[model samples]
Target: MPAPQRSNPAYRAIARLVRPVMMLVTRRDWHGAEHLPRDGGFIAVANHMTNVDPLTFAHFLYDNGVAPKVLAKSSLFAVPVLGRLLRASGQIPVFRNSARAGESLVAAEAALADGECVAVFPEGTFTGDPDLWPMLAKTGVARLALTTRAPVVPIAQWGPQDLLGRYGKVPRLVPPKRITVVAGPPVDLTDLYGRPLDAVTLRTATDRIMGAVTRQLAAIRGEEPPATPWDPRRAGRA
Candidate 1:
């Protein structure tokens, strides 16, 4: 097995504090660590089910030898202690729907070039699917993968929602939930690599990435996803 990446002091400190709490509140059933790239930078994409899943996802990657630099929402970097820790730990902030929105992409690209693991939730937020399956995702991940020519690893996780419901104010930690996280092989975007970054191309690439994630989630849940992934924008129009 590949050795775990060496994290910065701030990240290590934050992980030391968070990992124990996670262990106390959750049982981990992680698989497919072998699929993660042992040395080079890669984009780790996962389905977002609840607010807490990011922590579980990070735990899985960190435990498996990758120190993930997640692209988080800009608002998260504004909180008090959490904000300071996030900045200190080198987490990237995403300014959504603003002129600064593209900044996160640039940072992520640079991180990838430096051979760091960059984690992204392409759906951009928790899945709006009533069934908690992955929804249609934004194409930012596609852009990054193509631009950097980095491998895109698809991860699917189940059980974080049980510990903390999608919109719940309180966590259900009476009996620690079992968090099952599995990684699939790097998404096959080789054919689309040299293509132009147009709308159709981006959407095509995004669909393949999300499909891989949904398939992994389906295997974990032993259930089938919808024929058409839910689209928040389309639902809003209705």
Candidate 2:
């Protein structure tokens, strides 16, 4: 077997602290780890289910030998100790709806070039679908993948919602939840490569990426996803 990916001292330190807590809170059913690149940078894209899914997602990747540098909200970087750890661990802060928003992509591109796994929750927030299915996502992930030509690995996870609901502030820890996370092969964007990054092109690529994620989730859930993904704007929830 190939050696595991090495994390920086800071990331390793943080992982030591987080891993045990993750173990206490959840049981893991991870699959398709072979799909992860044994080396080099790649984008790990997953569906957004709840607030705590990020922890579970990171747990999967970290245990599989890759240290994930997530693109997180800017406000998270302002929180006390968390902010310092985020910076030290090299997590990218996304400045949303501002001139600096693009900065996150630039940083992510650089990280990929440096051979770091960059994890992205393409849904951008909790699934707006009442069924907890992945909703239509923004095209930023597609844009990043196309621009960088980095491999995009589609992952699906379930069960984090049991720990923390969509809007619940309290976590239920009595029964440790089973967090099932599965990764599929890198999305096939080769055909779309070199295409103009126009609206049509971007949306096409975005749908394919999101479709891959949704399909993985469907396999895990043993159910079919909606023919059309939920759109908050169309549902009057945006």
Candidate 3:
């Protein structure tokens, strides 16, 4: 099911503000857009490879008729004009490692309750996987999925790294890159929907969602995932 072109005035405003800039930066190929539910709130989960993936991904969702409300770092909301834009766009903030950390989920639930589309980066950060495949993810996705019992939609994207790979501090800015966004069928979590949100249940659901995202990514790359994903902690990235 595809969503309307714009769910609200805010989204329309954001689109007008961003579309032109992004159009000049890259080309896009979005597939499986029909998988998005036309109505009702649902969760969209995906791998995070670069800072700009959200911008590219948002274009895919918005064009597909789903207005996406993504959970972003709280600090972004503290910026001057950027903050106002985010709020106007109806974006949610995630306060990591602080007393307010849990607030993001609460806010997300409210968005879902309102029948809006919510997007999540279950891995919590860009892939630490050396090869850029998704790494072991946090269980927040499972908790949210079980809490709202909303559709868990997964998207796989590639090529953003070509423009802005992992904290390079600048986009390539020369050759325009083509970013690919592919939507996978919503993950099946019905078995765990009515169950307890226990640690085990959350972890299981997280894995299932990550698995679906990884598979879609693999399809886009035309390659298989490594048997063992890279771990920044184990690799001493810290």
Worst 10 residues of 1 by lDDT: 1-10
User: For model 3, how does the per-residue alpha-carbon lDDT over 107-203 read when each residue is reduced to its tens digit?
Assistant: 9999999898999998888888777898888898899989989999999999999989887888885678898999989999999978888889998
For model 1, residues 1-238, the per-residue Cα lDDT tens digits are 3335558888888888888899899989999999999888999999998889889999999988888999999999999999999888789999999999999999999999899999999999998888998988999999999999999999999999999999988999879999999999999999998999999999999999999999999999999889899889976311
lDDT string for model 2 (1-238, tens) is 2224567778888888888888998989999999999778999999997889889899999889888999999999999999999999899999999999999999999999999999999888888999999998999999999999999999999999998998889988879999999999999999999999999999998899999999999999999989999997797233
Error of 2 at 113 (Å): 0.4
Superposed Cα deviation of residue 17, candidate 3 (Å): 1.9
What lDDT score is found at residue 86 in candidate 1? 89
The parts of candidate 2 lying over 4 Å away from their true place are 1-4, 236-238
lDDT score, candidate 1: 0.92
Per-model TM-score versus the true fold: 0.96, 0.96, 0.94
Predict model 3's lDDT versus the native: 0.86
Estimate the overall C-alpha local distance difference test score of candidate 2: 0.91
lDDT values for all models: 0.92, 0.91, 0.86
Give candidate 3 regions above 4 Å deviation: 1-6, 236-238
- What is the Cα-based lDDT of residue 154 in candidate 3? 92
Pairs that collide, model 3:
3-65
Worst 10 residues of 2 by lDDT: 1-10
